[model samples]
Target chain A: MHPQLQLLVALQDMTGMIKEVEEKGSELEGMGFKTAGLDDLKRAREELEGQIEPQLMGAFQRLTAKFGRAVVPVVGNHCTGCFAQIPSSFVSKTNAGKLQRCESCGRILYWP
Target chain B: MDIAEVLKNTSPELFLPDLKATDKESALSELVAGLTAGMDIKNPDTILQMLQSRESLGSTAVGPGIAFPHGRTLAVQRLTILMARSTAGVDFDSEDGEPTHLFFVLIAPPQDLGHQYIKSLATLIDTVQEASLREKLMAADDYEAFCAALRGE
Candidate 1:
């Protein structure tokens, strides 16, 4: 994976964690797990986002707002985000292929 | 898509009754090492990194002695749950300030953002809250007993 894409993946994971905790706080509390430091998690997401370039991060943010996952894996030449077929040209062994967006969902695509 | 699916995917190898790790990193390493085969991507390191990044945000330790260390990543093809009992206990920096005896690592593909992923976690959390379940798990000498205990039998 490209280092930038890798960083984006990390940021998305962080964002997902925070969102789940917020969305599931009551259920988590029912099981006795403390849902604290969510703000700290947001801070961590910001810190991670700072590492990515503005242009890429802007696209990421826009796509994530439209669709829950900004970055998605390409499985069997199909975008897992929207299940659209990714063209063969974009699917390559090179790291740059992972940094491209799915023409269908516009979600960033990467090979798992 | 359901707990049965999660159960269907698991075997005795994924359940450890005697984990040797004394810290979170080693415990995760041990669990990830045991679960590498489940990752379709064949990248256990990426799975481990995903787990660690989630932990870095906050300890997933919920109750007295159980921790639900979970995350989503491209490494896994489905909702993967690998559980272990740290006989010596591991410090996961729990909010309760107690040693975690039960460790349940939940990792899945990013596409399972809703429904199946969250439901699986909820089911696991509900199952572990039973005191009888914990007692039986601690006494389980093998996978069958551990599973039975998990089922509240």
Candidate 2:
């Protein structure tokens, strides 16, 4: 993966974790149970977000707002995020470590 | 935690005794659609993407015919859970190689506090640990039966 794509993937994962932690925290609070680790995850996400370029970050945020997950894996020449099959040429570009987006879903595409 | 209390706030309408999807992807889409229907979800497509992304990380199928397909997204106002059963069973890429029969779709907000969501998931997993409990849930004919079985009645 390209360096930026790598960072975006990590950022997406972190964002997902943050959401999970927050949900768990709310559940625990409802049960009168205390929890932790959410702040650290948020901080981590912030730091990760800061490391990416503004343009790329903007794209990520836009895609995330539109698709929930801005970065998704390309599985079997298909954008698993939207189930759209990409052309072989596009897959080659992705395999060559180029950043790509699914034409249908518009989520960032990476070769896992 | 008391299972009933933990799930008390969950909407009973989210539980589906007869899921209609024949595959994992379609099942997820169906579940998400059902969960977001009539709600103010900004983007149902995005929510489905989030859930699919999580599944790609690894199948949530724990074992014994149960799968917990969950995702965190800002599309919803708060944490939500939807449960469904596939009588015909669907391949969820379970590690155990068994077809998944029960699905607990959990959706949480991006900024959630974290306690209630985790606790609810843990409670659900623990409750279904009993083989009989799994059987009862699978055999439940209606929503009431499903709730009763979940409550260990």
- Best model per TM-score: 1
State the C-alpha lDDT per candidate: 0.76, 0.72
lDDT of 2 by residue, B44-146 (tens): 7667766666665457777578887765554554678788899998888777788899988777764455556666777888788899889999989887788
Point out the worst 10-residue segment of candidate 2 chain A by lDDT. A28-37
Where does candidate 2 stray beyond 4 Å? A1-14, A18-112
- Cand. 2: chain B TM-score: 0.92
CAPRI category for model 2: incorrect
TM-score (C-alpha, index-matched) for candidate 2: 0.61
lDDT of 1 by residue, B1-153 (tens): 434545654677678777799888898888888786543455576777777767765678876788888778766767777878888999888887889998777777766746565677777776777787787888898988877667655
Task: Give lDDT tens digits, candidate 2, residues A8-97.
Answer: 766775577666545554653443322344565566668878999999999999988987778776657888678999878885644576
TM-score between candidate 1 and the true structure: 0.83
Please give the RMSD of candidate 2 to the true structure.
11.9
Best by DockQ: 1
| DockQ computed for model 2 against the true two-chain complex using alpha carbons | 0.06
Scored by Cα lDDT, where does model 1 land?
A: 0.76
